[model samples]
Target: MPDFDFTALRRFPDVEADNLFAYDASDHLILDEAADDLHAAAPGEVVVIGDRYGALTLGALALHDAADIRTHQDSYTGELALQNNAAATGVTGFRSLDLGEELLTGSRVVLMQMPKSLSELDEVAETIARFADPSVTVFAGGRLKHMSIAMNEVLGRHFGDVRASLGRQKSRVIRARDPRPSAESAWPQRAYLDELGLWVVAHGAAFAGPKLDLGTRELLRHLDEMNPDARTAVDLGCGTGLLATALARTRPELAVLATDTSAAAVASTRATAEANEVAITVRRDDGLSQQPDACADLVLLNPPFHTGSTVHAGVALRLFEEAARVLKPGGELWTVYNSHLTYRPALYRIVGGTRQVSRTPKFTVTVSTAR
Candidate 1:
């Protein structure tokens, strides 16, 4: 087998900055370990989970010559990158599905990039255990800094055996087999936020889990003060659809769109809206790049400061630009962010006139109108 071409991959649609990288050593480690498993399994029987930017999936297809590969990526941007890389490299015959039975059913081999959250690992473990072939072997890899004893415990709960491979380049792969098929799932967790009088459902991979983050809680305080005539609104970067649900409940006449980059967040938001009996459109998007200009009457955002494990403001700024594009003239963008970030100036320059709506010790809520 030849070496995989890392240069063929790119992280467009996601934040592409100097500090943040596209592929990592763990990707190579997992694909290498899964090579034997891939050979033993039938074509189209191999499942790739948590593949970031086509590394594990494309590498297997391009290098090992594996075909009919199925994949599940958590982030919308990651999926887009995989498609872009596949088009660029002229690789085809791979199917991408959400984290469900369609992606995991009857898979004898699984190559996964271990997620940062143990609960997310648990979600993957239980789903594969229940849905995949009973004899499936899972090759899960991650950097040593991100791996934990708790992850082994999480895997052990679903798999009969779990063992770690030798660490190379500060990365390690954990192989597990003999899945316990009867294991229960803990995902799509539900919790009631009494303060907001709303219930939120979150998948394990959703940001901030099932609880309301301080920034969002502060932002929700002013929901009643929104424009009375506002008919269309967006919960930009909506996580678990907390604000969307709140807005729907407060103003039942408004049409709300809840959008996020993470597939888990989109699914969680849909579940949350259904749980709260609120009607909203939930979608996975690369910010609002797909939205038409001046399509929304208002935009609400609790922008994320991190892309993957690295802290960067580029992700938030990208969303700000998208919001500015989506909102109509005189329309408003309500944003909640950490006080220390001091994003008011950027909001003013990027969107329009920005004014502090509310400020607390930890978070500041601001409203910027589309100029």
Candidate 2:
């Protein structure tokens, strides 16, 4: 085993802008705190989930001689970053997978970066407990600021015993043991939205979790004014397929495509679309990378404001660029964003002919036409 260098890691295609960082204190603390436990696990028995870059997976490989570790990263960019880091460092034998039986089966030790959402944590704990080896031990770490007693409660729902570590560097790790295999999973959860009369389905890692985000809610109000006669529409960065489903239901003649970078988001969108009885083509893609150029006449976007925990605009800007490329000449790109982010200028520059469709206290809705 060799000493690993954390500074060499990068978060390309994720967020590398100023005022935001690639890795965090929790990433290092998780590996360091679980060093002894990880060392004791067999080479092939370690699993990592939510590793932001390659910190946990690569660290285990380089420092503990843990080989063939199975990992699941919800974000496509995070997975790519892990691959790039592994290639750069010459580490091998780690497998990247979606959260499922294949990723967890027979694993004895699981390392996790605690998710910000309690539903996400619930899904991870349930899947790990139900699919992994009965004796598997889980170490979930996160910054103390984000950590909550609710996380432990979620873990307790799936595992028999849960314990916490003393905070170090404002980060802490929660350990859960004694899996409860029969626990009912709360993931791929289905909830009915009374306001829209729509059923939204979401996997744990999906953003907003089957609920209408305020921005998307604001955008939905203006969907009727969009190019209704357009043949093709896209829900770019469609988290939970709320926009796509709304569009499909409102305009049944339109062919809608829902694309997201997160595997979980893609799955959730697909589920949401199906649950709502709406037809949509859903794909796990980096922005609109899988869509042909100028193929869409209308594109709907509710771009995310954060990369991990940092409020960064890189993702929103990238999505805007991709939406511009995906929309045909004279097509329209409808967007809703935080009012303070002031995405109007970027929309005008990237998509052209920007106009404010609606604005509320928290969000601003804009329509940009493709020149």
Candidate 3:
């Protein structure tokens, strides 16, 4: 099969807008601004982040030799798109890693794709600051909506000196020159709930940040009731690993498999497991590709409905089908999604039975079982 290409969305002004095969010709912000800066960068061992759909990572990897440098990633889709685009483009040498993974302790340049969460960006900047200096040139791009005076403050706080390029096609790029080294914190460990108290593993990405989401909080409630007597169970789309953590907490006798598309999420779960001192299997997987057929007793999912600009049922539908494929007869999938999604019809077709267990104004939970 041909390598999957990422489809670009408008308004997420980013440094790697055009590197994607699915580039939006209509992209009018950071794409143009970042393109100009990238052309002038003398690349070697550069780390790129927030490359939504992976234009910047692809560019850095293809533009530089791996022996000279490496590119790291943390965005969920960014990793997926980066590997896909790399294979399709026949680009080699560069390996994709997550922020939750070890960061560039020796990277010379950092190319950042600003995220929607300014707090996240601040965290990234602080992480890089530990190793950044005047020798480290940080180049970043974003849309007008995100490019603000406040952003400059964050940049200044982490890196000493900064400048920006003129907006081209509504895009702007900031150049931060780090003169003095910034203090680095020990990587924060992921926290998992357990009898041991707190599980903490230093993860540098989006997975096990400070708090848990509401959907996962609700899903965690049913984990104790889940039949763990089966040989194996999987927590699909485990974010921050709260679901996986509960599974491990309740079923000390079973080896719980935890998986997610996000590298950070996977690492966080692993960290959570370690911090809680609970033993569970964790991996980065697209849906349940790594699972064996008829192997799981339960597949827990809080499936996301969209990726960037695309809002479709593709993710949820795939998880359901994959759950059925890997589930033994009578095995079930317990999942949650926004209440607005019409998932019942899709669930009925994928599983033998679909039951609505609970709902809120914004989200709903369903239990699907195979006959």
Candidate 4:
């Protein structure tokens, strides 16, 4: 049995905005060359990055009887696809990582699909360089439209020596031999929009790193009014650690757990935690991964409405339900969302109560809980 399938993805027209299902097809749009070849080579330990679905991951795992598979993905849907596909194929030896912590390196082979950000690529390069060595090989693959001659050069900078495979399915795989660790440079820094006349530092892979996002802005306004004495809190989708840092600053006594699914977001949040000199726990987590049931006093979120080019509410809905599961009785779950999302009814259904905290012309903030 194939470890994954994508028949369900056909119902949605847009790939970025809808509930995404794992697919066997490669559109050859965001391609990486190394990954194309690895479908055929079954090394025992395979690490995959930017696996949009469980496609490359489970395929590699199913190729061997006792295989080790690791994947780093940023979006909630991407992680969900990995699990759904893994369960479908019964391929179990897989590790799913978000944007930060350290990238798992030193695999017999590493597979990467091209991401949308250059800084992300650099971050992946730096993180993986820490864990790879001469014995490890990194295989990269991308669609011809997505790869350039410089693609191999970028791969060459870290892994040393690059060879390209003949194109198949309009996808070519690049073989990156000799995993020589690259020098640690200053982490990539970019600015993202925040409030008017204000922007924040975002490393690669944050949502709108050069500025504060619209949903996040809606989220930012609600933080100042939350109970200052709530002793335990969580920023469920703690992107770039901005909301978590602000929460820590405002509620000095509140123990806050910050998390995001993006490897880049995790790294940036870690840096943000260090820069603010606050003691917030930061991790690359799936939605509420490390959280315990009925424990959080407050869960703050600006749930994402889209994943990359796709727009949908699957992730936000998932987060809302997750918040419900993790909140203590009488604990509040707060979020800022697009007005068009009509998240209030769903909010009501999950937590049994919902109230609009505030709103902009384009967005609304709501507080819900099992009071």
Candidate 5:
């Protein structure tokens, strides 16, 4: 294997900060553990899933001369970052694909960055078992702090043998072999939310998965109160498309759009809209960047406070800025957030004058009219 420098990678087109990173110890650990298999595997036999940037894909190509690599990244931001980093490093030989048979259908070795959600892991594991060759070996890695015994159990369900590696650099890898294919897929789960009178659909990685989160529930309570004259609305960071579907169902006259950064979220939202039989435009976007400035009359947001496993306010603030950009004068931005975030001042400064619509002990709902 050739020496490859992982530090050359960057998280372009994604939020970058001193604390956030594109590559981590887990990426290196996964690659190192799968080194022999990656070198011996034939072209197109190696698949990478949950590659945050291009570390796994590019590292394989750079170090092992791996070719025709198929990769799947759930986050559009991560996908773009991988592309950008590949271009920057001039490391190429991989194709970004959606999570399915196309990405998993193969033989031999698989490198994966274990997701925080067990459901997501289950979906990926089941897909691998169902599609990949029975002889395939999967090396799934993550930071030790984020990993748990349950992850081994998740992998154990689909693999006859699942074992863990000794921790290295605060990271660990779980190796699984002897595929036990299942006939069923456990993803894109669905449930009916009685409170909203809507069916919520969610993929494994979708936030809050097929359930009405308390924050979104709080925001939905004011749906009828938002700008009665509004004709156009956007559900910024739409997870399961609850807000957009609800809006379209209640006011068929209103043109509603649902946008999210995660591929899973977009898929879930579209499924939710289809299940609810509501007309909604669902797009996988970075906030409302694709929307025209001053185009929306009202925007609903339940912005996330964390980026990945790291708790940070930058993600929410960026979404607020996007909401401000897409909202027209006199437009309203309704946001539901944890009370501890204290986003009122920032909302007032970024969007316009903000007013508290309702507040629970743990959550706060506010409406800011665009300036």
Candidate 6:
């Protein structure tokens, strides 16, 4: 094993702040717990999922001499960060892949950063069980505060044996083996939101997962009033493409684009749009970075308040700035967020003149016009 410096990793291209981090105790603990399996596995037998940056992938490559490592990172930002970190560390051999057979097939050892969502965990576990070698061992780690008994139960559904390791630095790893592959994958779930008259489709990692979140529901109420003459609209951070599909369905002439950082979210949005027979251009993007400046007449956002498990407003603020950058002068940016965030002042400063569209006890919807 080589001496690997986890602290040297950086979350570049992702939101970086004094408090936000590229790696965590969980990453080290997972690597440590799975060290034997990782080292003993044959070339191309190790697969990493949910690597926030390149911590697990790079650590496995550098420390275990793991070869032909295949990894899946849901966030596009995480993928870019991994690329940047690998280049900086001069670590090679790992390939970023989507969550499917190609990434998991013949995988004897799997290292994962446990997702916060149970559905996401289930999806990953099912995929591993279905595709990985029968003798595969999974090391799924997360901060103790985020780990729940439900996660064990979720993994147990796909793996016959599951056990937990002792906590280290407030992180713990769950080891699972004896694959119990299911006949079908329960992912890419769908539900009809009768109230909204829309069919929501979601992959496990998609936010709110095939359901209309309260914040989005509030914003949906005002979609008809958003830039009435707008010809081009963007559903920034479109989860399940509810807003994008709704906008397209209501205004067929509008050119709708849905952009999200999460691959699952982008896929879900595309599926949602297709299911509704609405034409929405879906892109896996870091906010509206790929869109040209002043190109959008309206941008709808239900900005997430959290960056991973941390309750940070930085992610939402960054999206606000992106929405502002992509909006034409006088274009409207309709945003829905938790009321406690009080993003009005920030929106006014970052986007333009802002006004409350609607407010509830828990959520607030506001529209900001580009200055």
Each prediction's number of clashing residue pairs? 0, 0, 12, 36, 0, 0
Query: In candidate 3, where is summed lDDT lowest over 10 consecutive residues?
Result: 8-17
lDDT of each: 0.89, 0.87, 0.65, 0.67, 0.91, 0.92
RMSD, each candidate, Å?
Answer: 1.3, 1.7, 5.6, 5.7, 1.2, 1.0
Candidate 4 all-Cα RMSD: 5.7
Q: Which pairs of residues clash in candidate 5, taking residues 3 or more apart in a chain or in different chains?
A: none
Looking at candidate 2, the ten consecutive residues that score lowest on lDDT are 13-22
lDDT of 1 at 293: 99
Query: In candidate 1, how many Å is residue 62 off?
Result: 1.2
Report the C-alpha displacement of residue 204, candidate 4, in angstroms: 2.2
Report the C-alpha lDDT of model 1 over 86-152, residue by residue, as the tens digit. Answer: 8988877698898889998889989999998887888888899989988899999999998898989
Ranking by lDDT: 6, 5, 1, 2, 4, 3
- The alpha-carbon deviation from the true structure for residue 304 of candidate 6, after best TM-score superposition, in angstroms, is 0.5
Q: Is candidate 3 or candidate 4 better by TM-score?
A: 3
Instruction: Return the lDDT, model 6, position 300.
Output: 91
Sort the predicted structures by TM-score, highest score first.
Answer: 6, 5, 1, 2, 3, 4
lDDT of 3 by residue, 134-153 (tens): 46667777766556778778
Better of 1 and 3 by lDDT: 1
Off by over 4 Å in 4: 1-19, 27-46, 61-71, 74-109, 125-203, 307-309
For residues 33-132, write the lDDT of model 2, one tens digit per residue.
7788888888679999999888889888888778889999988888888999888888887998879999998899999999878878888888999999
Between prediction 2 and prediction 6, which has the larger TM-score? 6
lDDT of 6 at 218: 90
After aligning candidate 2 to the native by TM-score, how far in Å is the CA of 222 from where it should be?
A: 2.0
lDDT of 2 at 221: 92
